[model samples]
Every structure is written in C-alpha cells, then in structure tokens.
Target: MHTPKADYPLSEIRRFLEPGPIVLVGSAWKGRRNVMAMGWHMMLGFSPALFACYIWEGNHSYEMLRRSRECTINLPTVSMMDQVAGIGNCSGRSLDKFETFGLSTSAGGHVDAPLIDDCPANFECRLVDERQIPEYGLFIWEVVKAHVRPDPELPTTMHYLGRGEFMTSGAIVSRRDEFRPGNL
Candidate 1:
C-alpha cells in the first residue's frame, strides 16, 4: 500500500523542479569583472556544446554580461557551499567577489571573462541569443573553450533545493550498456 500525495504550494515547486548543479557565472565588461552564484542553468545541445541560463535584469552581473557578450561558467565543489551561498546573497556591483571571497582567476583563452582557478572545471562561453531575455531573462550561449583540472581530489558538487538547503552529488551509477552507439 502507498500513501496518498498532497499538493504543495506553487511557489514551493522550485524546490522539487530545480535539480542541476550550482555554478559561478563570471563576466567582464570594460575593466570590471564579477562572479555570481547561479543555480538556474542547463545544457541545451551536445555537438556544439550550448548552454542556457537565466539572469534577472536587476542582478549586478546582468548588464556586464549583456555588454560583454561573454561569460565563464565555473563549477564549484561541494566544499565551496559557503562561498556559493555568500555570493548569491550579495550584489557584485559594490564589492569585487573574487577578492572578497579569496578566489583566484585566470584569463580565458577564447573570451574576456576570467575562469575561477579553484574550480575543477570552467567553461568559456559567448552569448549567442537574447530573444527570450525580455520575457524570461534567458541567455543562450555557445561554449568556446573548456578547462579542467587533470585530477580532482574532492569532485563532489552541490545542487540547490531552494531556501538554504542543498543536495550533494554522490556515487556514480552508469548504464553504458543500456544505450546504443547512435543514442549516445
């Protein structure tokens, strides 16, 4: 026997709907550079490697990203949860997040945005479309370059569950044999 289900509030649906890893979005315009914690993003394509993320118009990084037309997605490990939450709670307009958080960065090869040196993986991307920004605040990007650490000791990542909760990535389970070559 199973228990009956109850409907949750519409506003609380995001806790269950959002299930992707959190990322630090880095952008640069003029001489200013900023990094913002972002949990609303997803992969759109595979062959060319495309991504889409939503950035509110009021965010400090919004204008910088729009003006520069490029950004970097830095994947932080589970251990960096405190910094991730801290970055999301504050605006990047007044303080330099990199310096405040003691983050190190390196220049991206294909874009002006700086990649977070502490992250195990960083993707350099260029904005490809903004047709949905007015209605959805969505930005589509094409990944131009990808950098990763040769070996990661603490590779666990975190996924937000709304509010102040987060779920850490755990053991890997693969179904490689279940898929055909063409499907992969």
Candidate 2:
C-alpha cells in the first residue's frame, strides 16, 4: 500500500534535495586566513576536477576567496561535528576560526590557501571563473592539488539537514566489478 504524502513548503525542499557532504572551506588573503563551514557545493566534473560552491556576498570568506582566488576544501569526520557547528555559528571576520576551534593548518602545495590538518582529505583549488558571482554568487574552481590520509578506508562524514540537524554518512555497498575499465 502507498503511504499518504503531505505537501511541504518550497523553503523545506532543500532538506530533501541537498545531498552533498559538508566541508570546511579554508581561504587566505593578504596574510589573513579563515575557515568557514560550508554545505552548498557540488562536484561538476571528473577530468581536471571541477567544483562549484555558492558563497553569499555577506560571508567574510566570500571576500577573502574573491581576493585570493583560491581555497582548500577540507572534509571533516563525524567526530568533529561540534567544531563544524561552532564554526558555522561564528563569523570569520570577527574571530579567527582556526584559533577558536583549535584547528591546525598547513600551507597548500599549489595555492596560498591553508589546509586543515585534522581533515582526512583536503582539496586545493583555484578559481577558474567568477562570471556568475553577481547573479548567483557561484564560484567555479579547478582542483590543483589533493591530499588524503594514508588509510584505505574513509571516515564518516556528515550532511546538513537544515535547522541545526545533520545526518552522518552510513553504510557503503560496493559494485566495483560491475563497471567496465573505461566506463568509470
């Protein structure tokens, strides 16, 4: 039997539509460095590794990213959820999130941005296009360098469900042999 459904408001659709993982964006400009928790991002392509993220004009990191033209996407594990929520609640313009959250960072290989040492994976990216900023506040980037932990297994990551709620990544089902060599 089919279950009855109730219509939800348009504003609530994001809770159902957003599927990307939450990430900490690390940016630096003119000797200032900041890390902001972000969830509005998606992968655009595989070749050359493209990513697109929306940064509202009001965000402090927005100006830094615009000026530096680079950033590092840091993937935090579920254990760091408290810090993630804390970072999102505060503004980087007023307080240094790195110092507040006690996060350690190292210089990125290809970009001036700093990578959070606590994250298992860090992607260093440079802005490739900014034409959509005025209209959509979108910034497209090309990943220039990537760093990952030596472990073969991945740690649990979280996804925001809006209203201070988040869902942690669950079980994985592998079908590696189902795909042809060139198809992937």
Candidate 3:
C-alpha cells in the first residue's frame, strides 16, 4: 500500500529511500567530537558545489554542527557497515561515537571536524545556511574541499532505509556506454 504523503510527511516518509553513499558527518565542539549517519543529502549546485543535508534538531550532532558551522562528511566503504550502524544508533552526548565504533579520524583540509579515515572519500563542508522547518532542519553547506583514495576500483557505499534497514548499490550497470551503431 502507498499514499501521496509517502514522500511528503517529514516524519513518516522513509528517509534514504534513494540509494546513495553513506555520509557520516563529523563535527566537534569545544573538545568533544561526534559522528552521525545522515542520508538525506543532495547536491544543490555545481559551480560552487553547494550541498544540503537534513539534521534533526534534537540530535547532538545537529547541535554541534549548528554551533560550529563546520563538518566533515565521510563516505564509508562497505567494510565499515557495522561501525556505521553503531554510530547511527548511539548518541554522541552519552557516548564518544568515534571511539565506541572503533573509527579512526584525521583532520580535514578546511574544517576542524575529524574525517573518518576508513572512508574512501571525504568532503569538507562549511556551513552556508541553516533553515529551520517544522521538525527537522536543513543544513546547507558548500563543499570547501574533498579527498579521495587513489584506487582503481570504487568502493561500495551504504544507504539507510527505515527501521535499521540498509542497502548497498553493488556492481556497475551501464547502458550509456553499451550503445552500438545499429539501424533502428
């Protein structure tokens, strides 16, 4: 069964329904560092590389990001699945998520937030705007810098559905390059 609001309700609509990369936002405040899983991210522009990700107002990571105006968005590989779930389930306010998940971190190029070393790719984001909605807030940012491991094969990225369910876009399927010169 489906309804119009399946993609409308901010709470009921399943987040991460669109399969993509698993982005972990690393943020720090004072001396505390926290990382959280976020899937509601998208590229809003290209020239300046503007991006936007949704954050719940109540989340500890959200608070840190709102205050710090800086974050590192890490794209984890398939090998880091368990650690990814641990970060999403745990609260940074109560637990040091980075340590609890056994994730290692390094400084980003432009932000103070630590970037997860396990991830194949990382994006350093600087806050551009924070728009408050009814329940969730959207943090608009610009991709200040980026880093990618020099590998021939790309790593699989994870995505979140609802209720702890996740999926990974595995293998490459392409028809764009498969076209042949044929008389149609």
Q: Which is the leading candidate under lDDT?
A: 2
Candidate 3, superposed: residue stretches over 4 Å from native: 1-19, 132-136, 177-184
1-184 per-residue lDDT for model 1 (tens digits): 2122222232222222234789999999999999999888877766466789999999999999988999998888888889999899999899999989989888877899998877777788899998988899999988766666545433688988997999998876679899998654
Model 3 deviation from native, Cα RMSD in Å: 10.7
* lDDT, each prediction: 0.80, 0.80, 0.73
Model 2, total clashes: 0
lDDT of 3 at 18: 26
Off by over 4 Å in 2: 1-19, 175-183
Top-down lDDT ranking: 2, 1, 3
Instruction: Give candidate 1's TM-score.
Output: 0.86
What C-alpha lDDT, on a 0 to 100 scale, does residue 97 get in candidate 3? 86
**Model 2 lDDT per residue over 68-91, tens place:** 999988888888999999998889
Give the TM-scores of the predictions, in the order they appear: 0.86, 0.85, 0.81
RMSD of each: 11.4, 11.3, 10.7
TM-score order of candidates, best first?
1, 2, 3
